[model samples]
Target chain A: MPAIEVRNLVKRFGSIVAVNGISLEIEYGEIFALLGPNGAGKTTTISILATLLKPTSGEAKINGYDVVKEAAKVRQSIGIVFQDPSLDDRLTARENLDIHGRLYHMSREERQRRIEEVLEMVELLDRADSIVKTFSGGMRRRLEIARGLMHKPKVLFLDEPTLGLDPQTRRHIWEYVEKLRDEGVTVLLTTHYMEEADYLADRIAIIDAGKIVAEGSPSELKDSVGGDIIKIKCSDAENMLKKLVSNGYDAMLVDDEIVIKAKEAEKMIPKIFAIADEEIKSITYKEPSLEDVFIHYTGKVFRDEEVDEIEASKMKWRMRR
Target chain B: MEDEKMISDIYAIYLREILRLWRQKVRLVTMIMMPLLWLGVIGNAFNSVMNLPTQGDFLSFLTPGILVMTMVFTATISGITTVFDREFGFLKEMLVTPIKRESILIGKMLGGVTQAVLQGILILILAIFMGVKFSGAMSIPGMFLTMFLVSIAFVSLGLAVASKITSMEGFQMVMNFMIQPMIFLSGAFYPTTFLPDWLKIMVKINPLTYGVDAMRYFAIGVNEFNIIADLLILLIFSITMILIGGHFFRKS
Candidate 1:
């Protein structure tokens, strides 16, 4: 049986349909990612699977227990790290983990043993007694992840796990998530970063506007974009796109650049330069990224304006530190 | 087995509140100091100006009222923790757990009750030190009972309000609007009998009126309503508050 299942799950807040007919089936010991931009209902879908919100229609199950009818059982089997920081800042890391264990009905010995194990897993054992409020942002996120793993849940949901963290911390968190897979835990994560999904997810569902636009492995999704992407910075991108399309090349204009997809794109670059020698200023060819895949499926650029602003400030703050 | 898990869950939540309270040394100091100022400074100021129909000295008459006031203040504002938890995102951690929602509500209410009762005891001790008289050693347990009942009722009311309000500022506005009226109308500062008919109706409806009256009977050998009637009304009020608070908390 699948570790997690959702069948056309729908959630509506009055007139606004937050999650519209979403379906997924995640196997045991696999890491799945729901990749989307902000407001694409990634968090809403996770909330439903975590049993925090009831679906407006359809069904969801965790470890064979219905999310609506057998919610307690489902809760017992799943742990979640929410998008926002949820730790009790006044408490120490160990106390936070201990309380989480107690909430799940773990005994004294079990909580003690598990707290050490999870803290060590997150490399926070040395700071177990330190108050969460005193810790940095990355430390707090690690502690929250440790707390989520304290109960040995069958499935773990990580909502934007490394959002706003520095590059080093993001990589560290990614490593921890990767380690969870080896422990035979079914993991479902949501992320707006295409690179994060590409690097970590075994399978990804590209979501936009409350619907899954595409779903597959990272390579599979990228391969579906058809061929290598050649991005051109030219004098007139609009005229260049028209010229390239008239020449029977599959190309489109993205922002200020004209992108063309072709087999053996390196060889086609010279032929493209021959088509519009003066119009093309500079051209670069590379393997199609998940971003290209998103654009291919949704016909829109993948961007999170709010997250980008926050990320930029956080990056600047980290650089200052 | 299920019952054991639920009890453990409640205990865990209760322990978190206790831990948070213990860590906040400044808050603890201020909670005790506020009541001291009211009992020491306000009580003396009121003693020179006001005359009561019953009891010896205004300090003795004011002790029970101040005790109830201390508990009511601490209990009602204790729900601010809930608002902070919601704003800080810790509420999601508790809600996603396997335990029943009622356990979380009960645990929080009990935590608030514990803080209020502890503050009540401290104020009671301070009042005794300040030359206030009581009905003797046996009334201590009865006084505690009165404090407990009053604490539970107001804590539930506070939690009920907190559950509906997502912002701390909104909760503060509502609390300021509601708490002042409840305290003033409960006869905490004066005798309910001397009030006009309309004011008397407000006192009759305020649950803290019975709590303060019962506390007065236990502490100063004073009587307004029957002691049994006081306890009965407080009990009913607590249960009703719990039900209403539970309904709102579960919905939230």
Candidate 2:
């Protein structure tokens, strides 16, 4: 049986439809990723599946338990790591995990054992005694992940688990996620980072405007975008895009850059330069990536430009507090 | 087995709240000291400034008022933890758990009651240093029981208010706006019998008035209103606030 099944799930906030008729299935022990840009309803979808938000219509089942009717069972089977920080900074890491275990009704002995095991699994046992407020961002994220695992949930939901982290820490979190998968824990993760999804997910579902635009394995999605992607930074990108399209090349303009997909992009680049020699200032060709697959399917550039702005405003608000 | 889990779920939330209270040393000190200051400064100021006929020492008469005031403020302020949890996202952590919703709400309310009761005890203890004595029909256990009932009622009111507020600063503003009027109008610093007709009506309407009056009847056995009637009103208010607060918290 699938670990999770979402059937036409819809969530509307007043006049706005945040998640509109979404559907997908995640198999047992599989590392599934929902990749989307900001406001693509990834977090909203995760919230519904985790039984935090009730769906406006349609249904979702977690571990064969209906999210709305058997919400308690769904909550029992799943653990969610929210995109925002949720740790009580005043509490020690161990205290935080202890509270979670107790909430799940684990005995003292069981709580102790599971807390230690998950703490060590996340490599946070060394800092378990210290208060969470004293920890760095990466350490806090690791501790949050450990807290989510303390209940031994069958399915773990990570909503942007490595968001706003440095490259090394992001890679470290990815390793822990891979380890969880090895232990047969079905993980449903959402990310806007194309490469994180490519590296971590067994299957990828690209969502845009609250709907799945594409779904496949990394290699399969990459192959679907043709052979190679040639990205060009030039003067008059609009003119460059028109010229490339008129010359029998499949190309599009994305955020002041021209991108083209061809069978042999390396050979086509020289001929393309022959047509718009002066306008093409810098030309770079690379093999197809999940990003190319996204642009190919969505017909628009996927950018999380609002993330940094939101983070900045949050920082300002915190400083004021 | 499931019943045992439900009990543990409530215990877990209660335990965390106690731990948080223990960790906040400054808050502990402030909650204790504020009431003592109110008792000492206000009791003396009223005694010397206003030579009111009828009582054996204004300090003794004022002790119950200060005790109730402390519980009211502490109880209401305790609800700010909910706002803090909501704003900081810790509430979401608890909400996502598989535990029953009633456990979470009741557990948090019990925790706040515990803290408010502790603050009330400290003030009652301070009454000893002020030369106030407990006597007449009200026993020491009875005073403690009155404080307990009053704490539950005010804390429920705080929780109901806190459930809707989003920010700590906003809650603080609400506390500032609501607390002064509630405390002053409740006859916490003076007898309601001597007040003007309009002010007496306002004091009668304030819920904390019955808490203070009953506490006075308990401490030094002075009765502004019938002790049994005061306790009955407090009981009704506590139940209603719990129902209302639980509804708001569940919706939140």
Q: What is the Cα-based lDDT of residue A204 in candidate 2?
A: 96
Interface RMSD over true interface Cα atoms for each candidate: 0.6, 0.7
lDDT of 2 by residue, B1-252 (tens): 877887888899999999899988998999877977888888877777776577667888888888888788888888768888887789899989989989988788889999988998888788787777877474687788888888887777788888888777877787778877888998777777888998988889887788888888878777788888898998888899888888888888
Which portions of model 1 miss their true places by more than 4 Å?
Answer: A309-321, B48-53, B136-138
The DockQ for candidate 2, computed on C-alphas, is 0.86
Looking at model 1, residue B181 earns an lDDT score of: 84
Task: Compare the candidates by DockQ and give the number of the best one.
Answer: 2
Give each model a TM-score. Answer: 0.95, 0.95
The number of clashing residue pairs in each candidate reads: 0, 0
Docking class of 2: high
| B-chain TM-score, candidate 1 | 0.95
Q: Give the range of the ten consecutive residues with the poorest summed lDDT in model 2 chain A.
A: A312-321
Q: What digit string (tens of lDDT, one per residue) describes model 2 on residues A1-321?
A: 799999999999999898999988899999999998888899999999988889999989999999999998898898889888899988899999999998887889999999899999999889988988888878888988898888989999999998878899999999999999766889999998999999999999999888998999999899989899898999888887888889999999888888888899879988998899556678899998888898999888777568678657755654443
lDDT of 1: 0.89
Worst 10 contiguous positions by lDDT, candidate 2 chain B: B130-139
TM-score of each model's chain B: 0.95, 0.94
